[model samples]
Target: MNVFLGFLYVLKIILSSVASIFLMIAIYLLKKLDVFHINLRMLIMHALLCIFVNNIIQMLRFAISLSQNIKCSSHNQFPAPFCAFLCINGVFICMERLYATFNFSKYENENFSYFLAKIYAVLWMILTLCSLLKFWEGILPGRYNNSLNCELQMIRENPLKTQWHLILTLLFFW
Candidate 1:
């Protein structure tokens, strides 16, 4: 079991590194591509950035654990928030698409200002942080064994908090 787990960790590290690189390249290309509207492109780039950062953090965590032979829980909180943001970003993208669909005639000529895109990104960041703050509070101190693995299960100790996280995720995803 230990060997298998080690193998999985190595696999995760490699895959995450590759994913982060690809996402970086994709974000660069998106910046150069003129096909997408500015607002939509910004949203897509934000999503990609979130994923890229999350992957890089995960890769680093796994690499540190393997190299130091210690399971560090300190960095565990880093990825969950980004994951939440990605979910929220997905909802924003969907909403933008729906708006365009409903107002197709006006959408073609509509110029969504870059400021609006920045606002949307900031709003999503704030929302994700607020929601995650409560969730993290439930698990951060005195909640579970500090050395135990699988931080996801540790966060589940408080069912109410877990439900809140799930509700938000499902709400955005739905």
Candidate 2:
């Protein structure tokens, strides 16, 4: 058990390190270009943020196991980092979808800068509500599988728990 846990810890460290590297590159690239020029930046940031969240989640997971005094009893946990990642990522994905549907005409027009900013604000609010539903109200599935040493559970196991993830990964990429 000790060896297995140690191995998992090492794996988590490796994954997080790789993610941090990618995140650094992504941020650097974003600095060099505008948001429109590097749309992939949003996706990369979402992935890195999720990875960082997962690292924190894993630490808390171990700590919860080690400390019997902790009162939280959800066997399937959703740490704050993952929760925040899910919320942020979900909102971004939704906003992206909305843009696709509407063709983002207002955003493309120079005169629509103020309206576009408000659209972003609305997106933030929608994501906040969705995240509250996912995390606090249990609108989405809560049980996350641990078969693989990875961030986010398998879609098969958790279903639409990461609905936005699936849409972006499958539909957008295709």
Predicted structure with the largest TM-score when compared to the true one: 1
lDDT of 2 by residue, 1-174 (tens): 345655664665566566667666766666577775233345445445555544554455554433433222243334443444455555655666676558766545434345545654665566556545555543124343332433334455565663445444444333
Q: Which digits, one per residue and each the tens of the lDDT, describe model 1 over residues 65-101?
A: 6775654444344445655776777787898899989
How much lDDT does candidate 1 score? Answer: 0.67
Q: How many Å off is the CA of 153 in candidate 2?
A: 12
Ten-residue region with minimum lDDT total, candidate 2:
68-77
> Which regions in candidate 2 have their CA more than 4 angstroms from the true location?
34-117, 125-168
List per-prediction Cα lDDT, in the order shown: 0.67, 0.49
Task: Supply the global lDDT for candidate 2.
Answer: 0.49
Listed in order, each prediction's TM-score against the native is 0.67, 0.42
Best by lDDT: 1
Q: After superposition, how far is residue 141 of candidate 2 from its true place, in Å?
A: 17
